[model samples]
Every structure is written in C-alpha cells, then in structure tokens.
Target: MIFFIILGAVFAAVFLLTLFFSMPAFQKNAPASSLGKLSFFDTKGKKHHPNPTFVERIVLPIFRKFLSIFRKFLPRNLVESVSKRLELAGIQDNVKVDVFLGIKFFMPFVFLLALFFISIFFKVPTTLKMILILLVPVSYIFPDYYLKSKTAKRQEGIRKSLPNALDLLTISVEAGLGFDMALYKVAENIKGTLGEEFKRVIKEMEIGLSRKEALRNLTKRTDVTDLNTFILSIIQADIFGISIGKVLRIQAGEMRIKRRQAAEEKGMKAPVKLVFPTILFLLPALMIIVVGPAILSIMDILKVMGQ
Candidate 1:
C-alpha cells in the first residue's frame, strides 16, 4: 500500500513538472529567423506544405521547455566542450548543448520509469535489473559517443575530399581567376563535405569576416590535419604577398601525395584485416563441408553392419 502510494505521488509530481515546464511561462518566445519568408498558405488559402511530423509538432515543444530547464545547470567548461563537439559534428546550429543535456537527462528518467513499470507488472530478471542500472550512465554517455563518431566521419570525408578540392582551386587560379573566384568555383564544382565547408567560408567572408579568420575557422571546425596545413599555407601566402596560384599549386601537390600515401597505407592493412574473418568464418565453413559427408557415410556403414 505504501509503495503504491509513493509511486502514485512520484508520477503525479512528474506529470505536474512536465506540465509546468511545457507552459508558456517557462518557454521563451523567439521569432523565426530564415533567409526567406515562410508562408503556410497558397494563393487559394490551401496548405503549401504537409503538416508537422509527430516529433516536430509534439516532441520539439516539450524538448524546448526541457532545454530551457536544463540550460542553467550546465557547467561553463562542459558547455564549451559540448559546443566544440557540436561544431565538429556539423550540428552546432541545429542542436545546442542545453537541448542535448535535456535529452540526456530525460532519457534516463524514461528508462527508469519504464523499468519501474516492468518490475511491477512482470518478473524482471537480475540481469535485466543490472541493465536498468547500466542504462542510467549509458543514457548520459551515449550522446558523447554519437557526437565523436559524427566528428570522426565528417573529418574523414573532409580529408579525403581536400586534395580534389585543392586541385580544382589550383586549376581555376592558374587560369587567371582571383583567389576568391577560384574558391567559389571549387565550392560550386564539388558536391561533398569539402564543397559545403568552402561554401560556409564564402558565407563567412560575405558576413564581414576577413578571409584569414574565415579560413582559420574552417580549419578549426574541420579539425583535420591536412586542411590545417593547407589553410596555414594560404595564410602564409597572404602574409608574404606570394602568388596565390603558386601557393595553391604547391598545396595541391602535397595533398595529392599525402592522399596517395593514405590509400597505400590502407591497402597494406587490408590483408591483415581479412585474416580474422578467414579463420573465424571461412575456414570453419570449409572444414565442415569437407568432413560432414565422410562422417555420414561411415555412420551409414556401421548401421548396415549392425543390421
């Protein structure tokens, strides 16, 4: 009776808290900022777009409130770290640290509540109980792991695409286009991570940021060693009044060589990586196929002799 009463009180408190937070008093009103006007109606007063999805209509509002609630609790250092990770992951603008933290804190509560219900309604094993406990930390740490994975993949894409982008920039610059024009051409020609980053750099330049600062920010956001070297070379060229074409050609050559070396290194490791699958999966399958028929034939002969 006491346990039920306590559980009911906890649920009531949670429900009340969720309601309070979801109210307008706790939520900030921010005007939408977009490049163009967002109109929901057409000329005939018809809808121009589909209705919002479940997440957009319901989850986001709740999440915004939760975000506001959790925003104040983050430590300064942790916020900085989250900001850096989000920048590297290419989701800095889309997902703020407070929103991410709110999700992180909320998931464990959800997991706990779900487990509590399962424990009440059914028999939960000791292993499941252990897993329920483990889910708490996993809920918190999963975001970091996900963010790191995204950053790694984005960096790899940027690294692989850099040489090609540099080559294009070199070609355009040598053909008499100015540095900025050549950068524009490269961004327009390539359709990958490198292209998108270059487009961002261009936008930054347009927004009154100096070229050197924009390039530095590009390197910082990418966190790729090859790109950092390329940007450093450009910055040096700018400082020394060296010919942009000459600097681009040199950087492109170095990037091509580095890319080739990376390819060769991966080629060398391929056979070593294949060895594990051969022993664990292929070798066993071959042995089973060869030995099985012979064992079956021997068993048949033994049965016939016994008959």
Candidate 2:
C-alpha cells in the first residue's frame, strides 16, 4: 500500500512539474516558427535558447527563482569576488554570479534530496549518515572548488601558450605593425586562453583605456606571475620610450626557457610520484604471482608428513 502511495506521489510530482513548465508563463517570447525544433548540446555552439528542451523549461524557472532569491542575500563584495573568479575561470561569459550562487545554494538541497530517497530504499549506516550530512556542506562549496580548478587549468593553458603568443606578437611588431595592430594579429592567430585574454585587452583599449591600463587589467584578471612580469616589462618599455619589439623579444626568450624548465622538472618528479603506487599495487601483485605456488606446495608437503 505504501509502495503504491509513493508511486502515485512520483507520478503526480512529474505531472505537476510538466504542467508548470508548459504553462504560458514559462514559455519563451520567441516566435512560433522558432519553436518545436530539435536541439543538442554543442561545445562550440550557443545552447539553451531558441530551442529549449522540456527539462530546461522545467528547471530554468526554478533556477531563476533561486537566483533572484539568493542574490538578495549575497553581499556586494562576495558577488564581485565570485564574478571575478568566474571570469578567471572563463565561465563568466556563460554564467552570471546570481546563477552561480543559486547553484551553490541549490546543489546542497539536491544532495539532501538524493540522500533522503536513497535512505528510503536502503538502510543507511551511521557512517553513511554522517557522510550524507557532510555532503551537504561539500556540495555547497563545490562551485568554488570547481571555479578554482577551472581557473588553474586556464592559467596553465595560458602559461603554456604565452610564450608562443609573445613570439607571435614580437614577429608582428617587427614586421612593422604597431602594438595594437600586433595584438589584433595575435588574437586572430592564436586560439587559446592567452588569445582570449589578448582579445579582451584589445576591447578594453578600444573602450578608451590606455594600453598600459588594459595590460594591467589583463594581469589582474589572469594572476599569472610570468604574465604579470611580462606586462611590467611592456609598461616600462612604453613609459621609457623603449622599443616594443625588443621588450617582446626578450620576454619571449625568458618565457620559453621557463616553460622548458617547468616541463623538465615535472618529468624529473615522475619516478618519485610512481614510488608509492609501485609499492602499494605492483609489488603486491608480483608477490602473489611468485609466492602463491610455493605456499600451496608447502601446505601439501606438511599434510603428507603429518599423515
């Protein structure tokens, strides 16, 4: 009887959710012609508009509501910090601060709901209960960790690509293009995090910011020491009437050397990193293969001697 009640509840929930999303209030203001088309997820294409799935229609309203409610409770400084971190992660183009905070708030409740349903099906041990309790806080903080990881990956990509970008910029400048023109050329040629940042700097410059100010903002956004030092060199060169090509050429050489050294350092540490895994996994498997037969033979001989 309880099983039937729970099953009915699930069906009713689904029906109500479907009805809620299908209502006129949740429908997009897009024209009728743009509606009823199939859309799929694409990494390089715009998603979630002009062709939203039923799930999106259902979830987006709740997501927006959560965002609006949570936005009021978030402090101004926290919002700004999160916005900056998201920008550093390259996701600010896609997700806003309010949406991010909404997810941060929403994920914990989702985790709790999942835990509740799971506990209903199976008996949760004390340890599992404690873990489920701990998961709420972990889920709440997961957005920040995800942002940090993305930022780290982006920074690493920029670090690897910066030298090549600088080299391209150097060549462009040496080829008689001005610094701004060189930036445009590099943005056109490169296709990674560094290229995107250069494009942003160019936009800032176009919006009335001085080259030095735009470059400084780039360093601030990236928080990369090598890039910051390179920016400092460019700023100093621009101030002291030094040649741009000379500065870029020197910075490129230094960045290339640093990248090589970093690669070599990581390679050198590979064996050290393998040590614990070798002892824990490979050694045990080897021992089982080599010693298993010997143990079995000894047991058989001992039984015979006893008889």
Candidate 3:
C-alpha cells in the first residue's frame, strides 16, 4: 500500500508539472514582460536586457498561481500599497506585486501545514505549539518587513556613498570630462547601491530620457534627501546657466560637510543609546556583584543576634 501510494504521488506530481510546462503560454516565445529587462550597458552603448532566471520560472510561478486564486479578494488600495513598497525596495524588476502577494497569501498555509505535520509526527509541547501558531502571522508579515529593511538599507547606502561619488564626479568634470562621461566614470568606479543607481540613470539618459528626467527618476527611485538635494541643484544649475563643474564642486563640499555632521550626530547619540543596555543588563549584574555579599553578611549577623 505504501509503495502504491508513493508511486501514485510521484506520477501525479510529474503529470501536473508536465501539463503546466506543456501549456502554450510556457512553450511559446517568452513574453516581453518576462524578458528584456534593463541590467547594464555594453561598449557599444546598448542596454543589456537580462533573461528571467530559475526563480522567475519556478518560484515566482508558484506564487503567481496562488495570487490568481486570491486576486478578487484583495483590495485595490492594498495592492497599490504593496506595489509602492516593492518599488521602494529596489526589487521591482525581479519580483512583481502579484508574485509578492501570492507569497504573502501562501505563507500562512505553509506555516500551518508544517505545524500540522510536526504535531502528527512529534510529541509537541503546548508552548511550542503556541509559538508555532504565532509564527503563522509573523510569516505572513515577514516579507513586508524584509522589504522595508531593504529599502532603508538601500537609502542609507546612497546617503553614505553620495559624498565620495560626488567628489569623484567633481574631479572628473574639472579635468575636462563631460557630465555624462564623468557620471559614468564614477558609477563604474564606486560599486554599491549608489553606483548601481547611477548606472541606471546613465542608461536612462542614453535611451532618450533628458538629463532632468533621468535625475528626477533617480531621486524618485532612491528617495534619499541628500540625493534629491543634489539632483535639484543640478537641475537648477541647468536652468540658470551655471557651470556644471562649479555645481559639482559646491555639492561635493556640502555633501562632505553633511556626512561629517551626520557622523558627529551619531557619535553624540552613542552614549544615549548605550545607556539603556547599561541599565537593563549591566547594572543588575554589577549590583549583584557589589551588594550581594553585603546582604548575605547582614543576614548572617541577624541570625546570630536571634540565636
């Protein structure tokens, strides 16, 4: 009976997979949406479009399937909110909102199913069961939390790296490089979230986006205050007939000053941040070490007096 059941399961799984793959949608030339995303540029100044990988083919499809089932039940506002969050997280290219919602919708069932199987097989304690049950909600929330963290980190990276990148751009411009070439050089040299964003901007400019539009798009994508300030400054310089080098030079100095001030602010806040940990964990341990023996000795004396 076990052998037959295992064989039937395997056959059923294979049949489903085969049917899904054999569908004309999957067999036909991959959709433009699934292919040809802007990744980088080559020597000939052409945008390199990347093909979808394994995650897109397998994992995303599974989530997309779940999304389709529950699409009608989801609110339009909630979907738009999720889309904005994904865009901010800088994963708009790799993961669609539908696939993300599918994951969110499916995760609770996954957690409950795991718990069900574990309870069936193992002798589970009540506390553990409660924790596992709580985790179902957490699992549903984890993706959104992860995206928020990712967006925060990306913006922080841009903030930290902006000063140095600006300095390099200023130097390149001062040395007779055009703004586009200088920007491209800086993007190629400094690698990080900032560099990748600059590269994307450069690519955008190459593909018929005006410099202002490209810079504005960059500001939109990053949402970094300092970056937005720099973009606005550049745009204004273009409008008022200011030299690019002087603008770059001024922005570089300001960026460096702002970064220094930010560092000093964090340094000033460090003591305040440490105070809570010192009180909560270290102070109790220290009090036990210092006053514990004294309390013990006083107790002994009291016992002697009583005797």
Candidate 4:
C-alpha cells in the first residue's frame, strides 16, 4: 500500500508539472493578430502601409473568408430582422450594429463549446444536457433583449427629462441665442438622455444639416410623441414667422402638465402593484411573528396534559 501511494503521489506531481509547463506554450500557439493591416496615402502620390505579420498575412484573411462564406448560409431574413430590432432598440449606429451582429453570430457557437466542455468535465445528466442545449440559443439572443430593455429605459428617461430640457432651451432662446446655438448650449449643460439626443442634433447641424431637418431626424430617432409634436409646432412656427421663444414656452408648459399627470397615474398604480408582494411575502412573515408565541404555548400545554 505504501509503495502504491508513493507511486500515485509521484504521478500526480509529474502531471501537475507537465500541465504547468505546457500551458504557456499552448497560449503562445493561439492566434493573436485579428485586425487587418492599416494603410494610408500621402499627398505626393505615395502610399504608406504596414507589412502584415505572419498571422495577418496568412491566417486571419483565411478565417475571415471562411466566416464570410459561412454567413452566406445563414438566413438573410433573420439577419435583417435582427438588424431592424437593433435599430428599434436605439443601436442606430451602423458600426455598433455590425459589431453586435458579429458577436451574436459567434455567441451560440461559443455557448455550445462551453456546454460541450462542461458536459465532458461534469458528466451532466440527459435532462440537464437538453436544458443546456436550449440555453445555447438563448445566450445568443440575450444581448438583444438586454439592449431593448436599455433602450426603453433610456427613452423613458428622455421623456421624463423633456419638459426641463425644453424649458432650458426656451430660456436660452429668449436670452437672444439662435435656436441652434441654444440647442448646442443645452446639450453642453445637460447630462442625460435628453442631452444625448440634443448633442446628436447639434452634431447633425454642425455637419451642414438644417436645424429643421436635424430636429425632425431627432424626433424620428427617439419616436417620442411629445418630441414629434414639438417638432411639428416648431416647423409650423418657423413657416409663419412666429416668435420661437413663445412657441417653446407653450410647449414647455404642456410638457410639464403631461409629466405631472404621468406622475399622478404612477402614484395611483403603486398600491395595486404592491398588493401581490405584500400578500405573498410580507403577510406570511407578519402572521408568523404575531401568532408564533401563542401556537408554541398551546402546543406546550397539550404536551403537559398528555404527560
């Protein structure tokens, strides 16, 4: 027994040493270069380019090409649907959507690989195996759900902040700044969803788009009814040469009233929303605290009588 125990200990030590020595080599063999070579052109008809590293020149392009072909086999409609959903979720930036789709496309494979390793390591049962198989697809789509929820929350925040933003814009405009300049000033001062939207509007104007067009685009991007109405009012006022400050003041007042009503509605719903949790979670605990001592006393009395 002692001989066998010594042999097992030696085997274990050797195995650990081998694993430790092999890990760094395995990591070194893994690919590191993922991006393409960067190239630039000079003014005097000269081009500058970085020579591609071995992995970049040989391996990465092959992997990208293989991915391109693999992507062709995927359903076009499904990709389009995902893109549209992402657009609605306020991931309107093309580059971000591309990255998101790339991640989505790769995530299921990674999840399946993880599941494969886990099953191999743990010898999970068949029922759990089926559940993990389902989770692979779920993990792939989870980011989309998260992004949608974020977008909704952001939109709600913007809605809540709208009246204050409009009031500030009105004050700025009334203080002799042009509408575009007022928007720029408001974007600089504020720091939330409203500010972000206004910043985008300012950027569009800076890039030579008209104020009306930028505001209209902002409405379309946000899809908020109040903003849409505000934009329409501004356009109409612009067409008729009305005072912009007066228009903004009126709009701000209406928005403030709407916000107040929304708050009241939420307050009214709070009791109804609390009812289920109060009954399910808190009421049971309250009953236990109130009746526990009495129940214990009665049980003790019954025990004494039996004795």
Question: All candidates' lDDT scores?
Answer: 0.72, 0.72, 0.73, 0.67
Tens digits of lDDT, candidate 3, 93-188:
423566567656565665576567667766657786786688689867876776787788778878888999999999999999999999999999
Per-residue lDDT of model 4, residues 1-307, tens digit only: 3334334534543443333223221122111110011112112353445895664477445644655666567688866765565544555533333445555655566546555665666655677568658866875776677667766776787788788889999999999999988988988887776776777776666667888898887776677788889889998899899999999999999999999999999999999999999999999999999999999999999999999
lDDT tens digits, residue span 1-307, model 2: 4344335534543443454334332233211111112122212454446877765677656766767777878798988888788666654322356666766766567557656765777655668567667868986776678678768887898888888899999999999999999999998898777776787777667667999999998887788899899999999999999998999999999989998999999999999999999999999999999999999999999999999
Candidate with maximal TM-score: 1
List TM-score per model, in order: 0.78, 0.74, 0.72, 0.70
Off by over 4 Å in 4: 1-90, 109-124
Model 1 pairs in collision: none
Residue clash pairs of candidate 2: none
Worst 10 residues of 1 by lDDT: 28-37
User: Of 1 and 3, which scores higher on TM-score?
Assistant: 1
TM-score of 1: 0.78
Tell me how many residue pairs clash in candidate 3: 0
Residue-wise C-alpha lDDT for candidate 1, range 1-307, written one tens digit per residue = 4356335535643553454334321232111111112223213353344786665588667767768667767787877777787777665443456666665667677667756776787665778667767876886677677668767877888888889999999999889999998899998898766777787787678767999999998887789998998899899999999988888888999998998898999999999999999999999899889998999999999999999
Going through the candidates in order, what is the number of backbone clashes in each? 0, 0, 0, 0
Residue 286 accuracy (lDDT) in model 2:
98
What is the model-wide C-alpha lDDT for candidate 3? 0.73
lDDT of 1 at 43: 35
lDDT of 4: 0.67
